[model samples]
Target: MTSDQYIIQRKVNIVELGATLGNISDACRKLGVSRQHYYDIKQALIEDGIEGLLEKSRRSPRIGNRVAPEIEQRVLDYALEFPTHGQTRVANELKRKGVILSAGGIRSIWLRHSIEKKSLRLKRLERWAAENTNVLTEAQVQALETAKEEKEAHGEIETHHPGFLLGQDTYYVGYIKGVGKIYQQTGIDTFSNVGFAKLYNDKTALTAADFLNDKVLPFFDGFGLSLLRTLTDRGTEYCGKPENHPYQLFMHLNDIEHTKTKVRHPQTNGCTEKLNQTIQEEFYAVSFRKTLYTSLEQLQTDLDAFMDRYNRERTNQGRHCRGRTPMETFIDGIELYQKLVHKGELMH
Candidate 1:
């Protein structure tokens, strides 16, 4: 029977019982229904008959406590940009951008999208980067080829040439007694795994732009290669209004394209993230235990030495590295890059 029919019959049974027993209170007590409820059912039966006794369902969409469409879209965009961020972080980040959303509201939205976990967010980033490869550099086309295999199993990203895609990220190197907090701006060429790093006391839009201007772009320019695109996370240091933000403005002036990882999905820029881990494990872990540093310059001098060995001396087992030094891989790849240029695949 329909729910309405079942409810109507029950109401009828209660009214009939009251009449048969000749005591409304006795009928209600036996049925385990309250007297007031029985009276309400009787009044409904008298007024609108059986139809009035049936309960109505609230089938329409709820109005109150619902998030606005624009706000919802912003939340989803933020999720894609910073997939690793928790609800509190997302809310705080949005607030800085003039979007007011509570952590609970952000969590509710995340629950709906099924990206509440970091892994799901990273998966969404992988899917997004795969589907929207056009936004990525042309040199990154081979990454789509990597999709045939298990990406995580293969480890680092695959690139076409030296300037194909540069993975950039910020690393916190812990606080020194006199230096306060030391942040390292790190970059790596995905094709050759050639790495570059510069130390900074603070991480900001200016510092991010400066890393490229001083260390990254200069190295590529010295080799007469075009730095096509850079990949990073959606941090304020790397992203903002083109005219107002130093990093964005620098990119615009330099004619370099920018791409970013989904929020909390650092592996989208895996080359740099891997380098960060390596630097921490191989260099910082060893160096910190051996030396007591009081100045940024003192520590930086030692870090530069390590970076030199990493690029030119330390052997690597990267897919493109093939058990050669990063500098060797970078040098050998130049010929392959030039041949592609001759084939008209790359600009002359």
Candidate 2:
């Protein structure tokens, strides 16, 4: 039973015990309640029935600190209009319109309405716009259109085969005891989950180009697979005017298509970003204190060994290669494609 129901039942039992015992003091002593309290319960039951025995809310009716309905509606409207904005930004926008609210208060409102996440809020707004286009203001209609366009522009990339798309990025591995700050150039095939990494003392265009040429290109070439495209962030190491950047020039010379991610979206190169994180957690973090390396050459050798084990033995739980190691997934995909080609079921 609920606490309120239990409390009411106990009060009724105490009253009943008083009536049966024929002594108020005895009943009060047995029930551990004062005689006056028993009388109060009896009077409440007589006046208002069972509900009178239940506990009532202790909170005041006039909650002065609560947000006004109109202000709350304004907050909701502002959030729907710019679903990508954070709570602070939304609150600031509301304040500019003379609707002052703390960021926490705005977030609380968002939480109550289940619109805290940008994606959910956008979906809600889009649904509302679609259902009530005749009633929406011009500005609201325009905002909905803009949100749709933004969502379309940032859609996920789809890769059909192992060598179709590769993501490359650089990571700064911290300084070692004997070595200065080291950087790692990492690349990963998005479809196969196969990864390549090389450590460098610096993050230069030349280093990036050399890593692609020596490590990544050679490995794929050994498998008789051609890397069609490379994706990287718009960092100076990977992108610039085609005539000036070493990395861009290298891709051009090798007949590989070079694609740079949108200005602020590092997630476009998420595969290599994840590879950098894995190397840091699995290799660098574990090996830094366990092994002593007096030179960069020694560290590079260890890194290469770790990469070999990672590609051959570590089972990738990625969607494309659920239970297979990277090398296994790569080879299997290539063989499948070749078989389809030989049977005249797939085009070149």
Candidate 3:
């Protein structure tokens, strides 16, 4: 029988006995139920009729002590502050800063704030990087062949300076947890072969543009004193979706021209292409160790620190550098650049 039916029957038996037989204990014994159970049924029947004996409301008590909005915002703020970091990493950071919370709680805060899992972007980038990898167009093939022929005829390929020419490409460091091991968009200065990278979660026109505006452009205007050219591949990062790809607009605004390497032959942009691979070997490989990163913000911080050290302190084997760091070379080049400027030969 339903609990409500059973409760009603028991209460009826108790009442019938109390009125006719005058003993609730005797009535409960006759009904094969305890005295306490009978009394409980009696109370429920009087207060709630049949419904009280049924399941009561299962809702939880209102959590007036829920996490504060500002606390959750703090979690999001810290996560953005360290882009390469994941929710778990952010949780640790919060803990380190003495914010007492469970990892799951911190993750919930991230979710509530619409902070997506970093791995999602990494996976998308990995797929795109794989799809576009080494698949050169017919035009690119012909260009490679032409460049090879010219090199054979002249012994050295004609190249140009930073703003005059930039070479763009991608490099890989093993699989990342969220994003598989795919290509990270990279660039090099044709003049000095100095390198930089835009570690994309995936390549979108806007992401590429943002990378250029927020990261690459600043580097050019600052550290790369002689930058006058930007070389790139005709990848979507540069060409397709002009509305989203800010590099085109940026180049137009600065009055700088972007040159693309021959379609299939990255060797035409060999300087930056080579440096992309070198960065994979010299920095990413060492730092990432082929494991998935927990956070992009953390990774960016590490990359920035490494780059600064590389430019200011690390010794290079290239003849152009004479074992000096890129920063040291840049400092020396300033004097030469001023001389060229005085002679009306060089322009910023």
Give the candidate number with the greatest TM-score.
Answer: 1
When sorted by lDDT, best at the front, the candidate numbers are 1, 2, 3
Writing each residue's lDDT as its tens digit, candidate 2 over 173-281 gives: 6655456667788898888888898889999899999998888888888887778788888778987788988888898898888888887776676667667766754
Which portions of model 1 miss their true places by more than 4 Å?
A: 1-158
Flag regions of model 2 displaced more than 4 Å: 1-156, 339-348
> TM-score: which is higher, 2 or 3?
2
Alpha-carbon lDDT of model 2: 0.75
RMSD of candidate 3 to the truth, in angstroms, is 21.1
Alpha-carbon deviation at 208 in model 3, angstroms: 2.8
Residue 17 in candidate 3, Cα distance off native in Å: 99
Rank by TM-score, highest first: 1, 2, 3
TM-score, candidate 1, is: 0.55
TM-score of each: 0.55, 0.53, 0.48
Better of 1 and 3 by lDDT: 1
Please provide, for model 1 over 1-348, each residue's C-alpha lDDT reduced to its tens digit, 9 standing for 90 to 100.
Answer: 987788889889999999999999999999999999999998998889877888856786566777998998999988775565668767766875789989999998889789888667756765676576424332223222221221231245547999988999888777655567788999999989999999999999999999999999989989989898888889899988887999999988988889888776666787787788677645664455345567889888999998997898666768888667789999999999889888989731
> What is candidate 3's lDDT per residue for 190-225, written digit by digit as tens?
454455665666665556556656666787678455
